[model samples]
Target: MKDMLWLMRNIWRSTIRSKILPVYLMLPLLGVFLSALTYSSAEDETVLRIGVANLDKTQLAEDAVQYLDGLSHIQVQMVDLSALDGEVASGRLEGGVIFEQGFSEGVHSGKPGGLQMVSVDGEQATRHIKGLLAGYVNDLDAIARIAKGDETVFAELYNQARSKSVSLSGEMVDDISADQQKSRQSIGYLITLMLFFAMSLAGNILREKENRTYFRVLTAPITSRSYYVSNMVVHLFVMAVQVIVTLLVMRFAFRIDGGLPLWQMFVLLVIFALVAISISMVIVASARSTALATAVQSLLIVPTSLMAGCLLPIETMPAWIQKTASFLPQRWLLDTLHSLQQNGISKDVYLNISILLAFTVTFSLLAVYMFERNEDTRVFV
Candidate 1:
């Protein structure tokens, strides 16, 4: 125990004196701030701008325009038919809806109406606009069928339908807010940065070996097991500090709503930190030199972090890539964060935590085996 504490203290002192520690400590803060800025800008961009060109000048056309304006995700503006294409092409509008002169007449006569959607954007952006217009047309078609060309009765019934209301009361079975999504993304980036920082311990171990301090330590009363344990302790301590500082900044400084208690997030990150440390041990154990270990760490960490949805949401990736993410420990940590946000400590959380713990133990045991079998590496000698 004494030897372990002494080694841990030395590791801490060395880290404090080194230039690399500040870089590692600053990475999470910078990453979180940049990500938050990006997310804020993206949210602003999601509000679609649509233009309505009502050539019919009828009650039905006016109603259609009003309905479009009422939609929560869209901002509708009244515009001329001549301006529709120009506005859409110039990027002032996402899409335009054109109501022809016979729009209301066609609905009254039970004939197909002329409603055109014009947009330079792809089919996906205009799809929702088409759906909304289709709904209005369908409702008009139904009213025409019922009225059988009686305009006065149709008008009366339409107004009556608009005014009628039915009471609705029910408990929310599930709720996933936008704040939760922001929190998940923010936490995901932080976790990825922590994993990368944790892997730096491999370089530390390699440096000690290169300096022959590892041999000097072995000559003392400390066993190789105690030295390794001390490394794990130091790595975990650094990770914990990173996690806490990032979370506090996210909650207080950025005002991000993580959707879960800070304690829960801390617990999840600490578990993932263990997995990261163990994986670092494996990398260091497998490499015979610091350069090899550094190369392996870079090659594995960047690609795995990308696959694990650390850089972007997994849902946006291709199906096969998402499937590949399942094998990564970072993916499991993100999955755990998502589960906690949505379900609030359910069976899924336990399952994800268990999977992370399994990864930690498995990688740790493999690292130990490699350390014991490899005689060229002086880390455990």
Candidate 2:
């Protein structure tokens, strides 16, 4: 036990001294910060500023302008036709309505209406306003017809004027918790990857063998198992620190209400980080040269990140892609974190944790076998 502790300490010291910690941590911190900024849809909440042009300026046009002005949750300003073009071009106004000359004349005569809306978007900008104006005009036109002693069509119009609308349910289509879940879940994958790469073990694995550092370490009263075990223990220790720091920063600095018990979230991340350590060990085990290590790193990083949904939105991908991703341990690891953030740990989340543990054990066992088998001390010249 004491030997394991000493070996662990030695590995920890080597890792921190390699200058990898700062680079690894800062990269993920930057990623999380950028993601936090991008994920917020606050800009979409800005109110639309609309301009109106009423040419005739009669009571009918005034009423139409007032109706447009009275639009709920929108800002309206009355401007002349000249100002309309300039303002819309300058982006000062989204768009507005223009009541043409003789609009009331056409209305009273019961002829087809005359109104011209001037804007970049011909009908789109005015569609809602047109509907409102049309409704008001339709009812008023019916009244005018009744005032003209024609009550026959009013009942017919009212009876024939049926409207259809689709009903929607209030299924938690978007839980307030989901946004934070995705954000934190992304942070988990990024931090785990950064830590895995930043350990500097892969780059140095063959370096020590070439420099006879491994020989010197072999002279120490430690078996090869102890040496590799020490590295794994130290990696796990670093993983713990990384998890704590990230979660604390997310909670206190970002103040993101990820909507779960903070402790449970932390537990989920720590377990995933352990699996990351084992993967890093595999990276080291697979390398015969730094070049080979880099090749392996590139090969694994993109595909693994894809499976983890770190590269793109997995939900937007095909069903087959999502289904295949389920086989990846990284998928389960991040899914666990997302679950923890949405709701406290459940049986399924623990199942993900178990799968991650299985991956870690499998990878570590393979790494140990490779470590034991490696006898080649040849330097890559």
Weakest 10 consecutive residues, lDDT, candidate 1?
Answer: 372-381
Tens digits of lDDT, candidate 2, 187-218:
65565465455335544555676677765776
Cα lDDT tens digits, model 1, 17-129, are: 76787788778888778778887786674778998899999888898889889988899988998888899999999998888999989998877487888889677878998
Model 1 C-alpha RMSD vs. true structure (Å) is 3.5
> What residue runs in model 1 are displaced by over 4 Å at the alpha carbon?
45-51, 73-95, 119-126, 147-160, 167-176, 375-381
Highest lDDT: which candidate?
1
Q: Best by TM-score, which number?
A: 1
Query: TM-scores of all models?
Result: 0.85, 0.76
What is the lDDT for 256 in model 2? 59
Q: How much does candidate 1 score in TM-score?
A: 0.85
